[model samples]
Target: MQYSVLGTTGVKVSKICLGTATFGVAPTAQDADRIVGAAIDLGINFVDTADVYGNMPVFDRPGAPAAADREPAEQILGRTLRGRRDRMVIATKSNGIVGLDINDRGLSRRHVIRQVETSLRRLETDYIDLYYAHDPDPDTPMEQTLAAYDDLIRQGKIRYVGLSNHPAWQVTHALWIADDRRQQAPVAAQVKYNLIDRSAERELGPACDRFGLSIIPYAPLHGGLLADLRVLDREVSGDQRFQGSGFSESEIATAREVERLSRAWGLAPYQTSLAWLLSRPAVASAIVGAETVDELHANATAADVELEPAQLASLTALADQPPAFQHRAGDGPERPPATTSSDPTA
Candidate 1:
């Protein structure tokens, strides 16, 4: 497997990270064991999960299953990594509904502190390699959250901080806050980026590039739309993203074109998809999920597939379209330059 440094950190992680979002739901506990074992055998040392994963029923939905009946993804992962926990760069997140209490969620100091302890116990680990604020918490001031993360870093509870599902402005704000406070800042970002979704490139990509933050893209397959070309001809059921609504017509058409290109290049659809994502700027790794051991092996091999420059260009042109505003004949007015001071928050 290939490896890359996570942002500016000295530590290296596999280009393909094993995602455990489907751990307790699609794949049984036994299946998880085999899949994780195979991932390690294939040289994948990075794993990503969230406290809210594990296919649990909605905490607030009426008629939902009792809290005791839930099976958190962390618990399943903890059991699977009994003796090999130290061999992986494990990442988990907070700011998700883990209980029915009003204070059970958000990036508040109380929630972050309480959840870190809960995650440690569930994962059977003393410290988390990377901890993320899963989503933005507008109610809680950014300083309060960063202060909590800084304290955790000083305590050695987490090695690094990351942000997920946050807007470009918020990401920069957090970085500025950390810099101003002389606290540890986030070194990476986890977002939904793939062949079908290039939205991250709009502003998030440039922000990460300028701030030295690595982009660890999840859902690289677009909910399996790019995994296999055959899904086009068959019915898609039980899919987490496209189960009920189904894929849009344009999305299917794009997948079909990708399939044709993959055939011409003599490569699997997933390999082509993953290679293209890895080639993007500021991307440190792509998180891929699998239901079985064989599936994991197949996805893991993408780390070695390298596309030709011409091939990469063609695939990129398929999805990376410029904004409509840029199509105008005349150039738009120039914008003001960003802050040049050492403290961007100033």
Candidate 2:
């Protein structure tokens, strides 16, 4: 596995970070353990998860059989990493209105402090290497949230803080606040990027470039749409791609075209999509979810799928279209290119 510096932080992280959302959500603890071990064996040093991830029911239902032993997701992950804490850069998030109480969610000082303690306890870690505000909290002032993050850094509870699914302006303001206040600056920003999605290019992409924030992109393969036609069909039916906002029919067709190009290039559709994502320097890691070792191995091998300039150009041109909302002069559907951002609160 190859590695890259995470933004200006100078921390070396694997280009392919293993996302743990699937680890404890559907897969049993034993299965999740094997997957985590497999990821480590493959040299993946970054793992991403969230407090909300633990609460997701299997098959998206309200109540399903919990993974073996019925442990919460974070607890299972913590148990799996019993003696390997220092071996990986673990990142997680907070900010979901988990319960009906007001303090149960949002990025308020009360919530951030309370949640961090809960997260550390659940993950069996004293300090979180990276902490993220899952989404913009309209209820909480930016200064209040930044101060809370500052307190964590000062207390050594979190090494760095980041924002996901936030508008560029908010991210920029937070960075300035941290700088002026002389607090720990956000070292990274996680967004969504894929062969079918280029929306980040407009604001977040450029913002990261100017601010030197590492991009931990999720759904690098458009949540399996670019994996294969069957998965693409399932994704369309499920409306879970693009951070669960679903995709246009034209977007689905465009995803299929990307898959066809991958076959023509003698690569797995997923590999091609991942390889394309890795080519960009701003991306610190692409968090890909997998259920088995075979799937993990296939994704890990994407590091070797080098694309020539010509092939890259062809794939980009084919998938590069305006957002579906745009209209064309000739009256042809102005299918928008695929674009995904960090997972927003739904």
> Model 1: clashing residue pairs?
none
N/CA/C clash count, model 1: 0
TM-score per candidate, chains pooled: 0.89, 0.86
Which candidate ranks first by TM-score, i.e. highest? 1
256-290: candidate 1 lDDT, tens digit per residue: 88889998998888889999999998999999877
RMSD of each: 6.0, 7.5
Model 1 weakest 10-residue run by lDDT: 322-331
lDDT on C-alpha atoms for all candidate structures: 0.82, 0.75
Candidate 2 Cα misplacement greater than 4 A, ranges: 57-71, 232-248, 321-346
Pairs with backbone N, CA or C atoms under 3 Å apart (clashes), candidate 2:
196-338, 197-338, 197-339, 322-336, 323-336, 324-336
lDDT of 2: 0.75
- Runs with alpha carbons beyond 4 Å of true place in candidate 1: 58-70, 232-244, 320-346
Query: Model 1 residue 18 lDDT?
Result: 91
